[model samples]
Target: MREDDWLAARFEENRDHLRAVAYRMLGSQQEAEDAVQESWIRLSRSDPASIDNLGGWLTTVVGRICLDMLRLRRSRPEQAVGEHSPVLADHEVPDPELEAVQADSVGLALLVVLETLTPAERLAFVLHDMFAMPFDDIAPIVGRSPAAARQLASRARRRVQGNPDIPEADSSRQREIVSAFLAASRSGDFEALLEMLDPEVVVRADEAVAARGAASLVRGAAAVAEHFSGRALAARLALVDGLAGAVWAHRGVPQVVFAFTISEGRIAEIEMLGDDDYLEQAELTIIEK
Candidate 1:
């Protein structure tokens, strides 16, 4: 293989690992993939000969890229998918991180907790705790000393380890809740809708969807209830990304995806995906029961 081919091949070898780190850092598959791709781009443009331990180098690059992305996320209202306060005090979606080495995942609830962490804290925690990277290696990425990085990891670890028993996410219960929500929306049962939603429930819409005159971000139970109640008549139940969710489809083509973060038997947050690309990428499985 030629030099460029060799370089591309080497990066490909670390792609999965890079993507995993990014996912933990950013909590959105799309953004994680973007970070990995950006790393590849940077690799292609840099002096390949100067690099040693390509895996570590790529990891650091992705880490820096994700740090910047996480910082940007902090400044945004919509934030990253799955990166928000845990809606449920005791609920966890299937763990995605452990899917590689084990059959189970760390669950979406952990990701939500990680979102509460600052950019540096997240980087330090994910890299050191999740990937087993050393604090020394993590420091430069967050622009902190090794000791500071260790402290960041320690703080994050305490927060993460403190939540040991996130309630087992029950798909059956999820289906029922979503069904009730749909029923309430269709029948204009505002009270029922409010009951199903957490008081601080937040609903986020894609920019494209928001630009069309819909509210981009709706917060509070009353406001969120007012938006969904008497609406979503066209939506039907589906296993969005393998979790219980709802979708709005026309003639089998989905136009919208409603991803939920449920907790304590209430809808804590609803993330709306109206972007065509997001709809296309959604892994929607029609729920039969």
Candidate 2:
């Protein structure tokens, strides 16, 4: 095949993985698409023969583009935060059968945790932790020394481990938490709800379109119980990204799907995808209201 044809085929084959990386980095499917498209443009103009590891090279290109995007957009409202907080907290719809060794790495909560790091830190950590890219390979990707990359990964690890967020788990365990959350909400049992959450829990929605950050970031079990005493049932629960979360149904129509990040068994972070326009890109369904 001609070089261009070969590049095209490779791009097609790697599109999904490329987009996943971009999306996780930037937290906006539109932004990720833009980054990937830009990478393709660069790829089309380059000589393929000089490339040794096309997959790794393409991923680097996309990662760099995303990093630049993150940098350039730093002044905008969407300036990369410690996380991509969506206005609608409960709208994630992930493919149940998607197979991959790192499927659990892309949780909304985890992504938010990723947001806390600087661009270089995020890149270094993701390449080393999520993809298992060697520190030597990761150094050039972030324009840091191999030692620096290693340090960045180490720092990122410390932050993640220190923060009391629950590590992502299998589907059955996910269902257990979801079920417990849902049951607590539906049964009007505040004590049961308290038992399901961790002590230092926070409930925040995206400020881009959200009006509130936790109604109350209660400290202990009793405080959590007090907060949920009469308010739990007002919200509706749905399975998002294979975890239990809330979906706001307006006028009997699903308007937003929110996803939560659980840590230490409590809600550590909450993200909502309220931009209805971006729902389709995320493969999510938005009902009426």
Candidate 3:
């Protein structure tokens, strides 16, 4: 067999693991695929005979590329005109324990939490805590001293604990609560909705001009019910990121989607991403009934 063929075979064998690693670092599947593709291109240009451990080499290349992408993205200014935001997808995720050792961070909620962390802290924590890489190896990934990498990871740990975005709830219970929420929405039972909702709740619909910010929150069960009143919303229930959510369509076009974060059997937060951008990412087609 040709030397190029041999190198291609080795790369194909480790592509899945590489994709998983890149996905965790980049937070988007499309970008992750891009990182993996770039890594392979870099690998192809090098003499395969010189590389001893192909898997490790590929991972290091991908990790460094991802770090560069993150830094460049941070440095760029926000778009003054309409911007195209990458829509996040909800898929049938793998078991976290199985992927944890390999550094495949699976949950969307966890990814959102990671966004609060600095780029250096994220690299250190993902490398050391998720991938089991030592500080010595991670220091180079972030271009910091070994002691600095350790401190970065430590600081990240504290920030993650300080203001966690979501709370831990049993998966089964969360599903059940989501099911109840769907039933209530379909029936328009305000009492059931109130019972399921926590006294302090927040709802932010992406289509609303306010879109985001603390001031946009809809507090209290009464306010929650009032907001839903007089709306002609037709939705179907689905499991998104192992949590309950709804897909609302009007005139055969998907207009809104709502994903809830439940805690202690009450819905604590409701995140509504109503942009049609989700239609392409989720591959959803709204049909008129």
Candidates' TM-scores? 0.50, 0.49, 0.48
Go through the candidates in order and give the clash count of each: 5, 19, 0
Candidate 3 structure quality by residue, lDDT tens digits, 1-289: 9888988898999888787777767676667779999999999999887888888788888889988977776776572111212233366355343245235344555666666677777778777777777877777888766545765776676566664222445656776776677667666788878898889988865433245332356888788866654342566665543345666766755556666777777988876655432343343322223
- The residue pairs that clash in candidate 1, if any, are 88-263, 90-167, 95-105, 95-106, 95-107
Please provide, for model 1 over 1-289, each residue's C-alpha lDDT reduced to its tens digit, 9 standing for 90 to 100.
8999999898889888897788777766567779999999999999999997899999999999999988888888675454432222245454354244222334567776787788988899989988999977997888866645765786677678764232346777888899889899999999999989999999987665677677889999999999988998888889875567898877888877788888898999998777664465456787742
Write out the backbone clash pairs for model 3.
none
Q: In model 3, how large is the Cα lDDT of residue 85?
A: 21
| Predicted model with the maximum TM-score | 1
Of candidates 3 and 2, the better by TM-score: 2
- lDDT (Cα, 0-100) at 189 in candidate 2: 83
Question: What local lDDT score does residue 197 receive in model 2, on the 0 to 100 scale?
Answer: 71
Instruction: Output the lDDT of residue 142, model 2.
Output: 81
Clashes of 1: 5
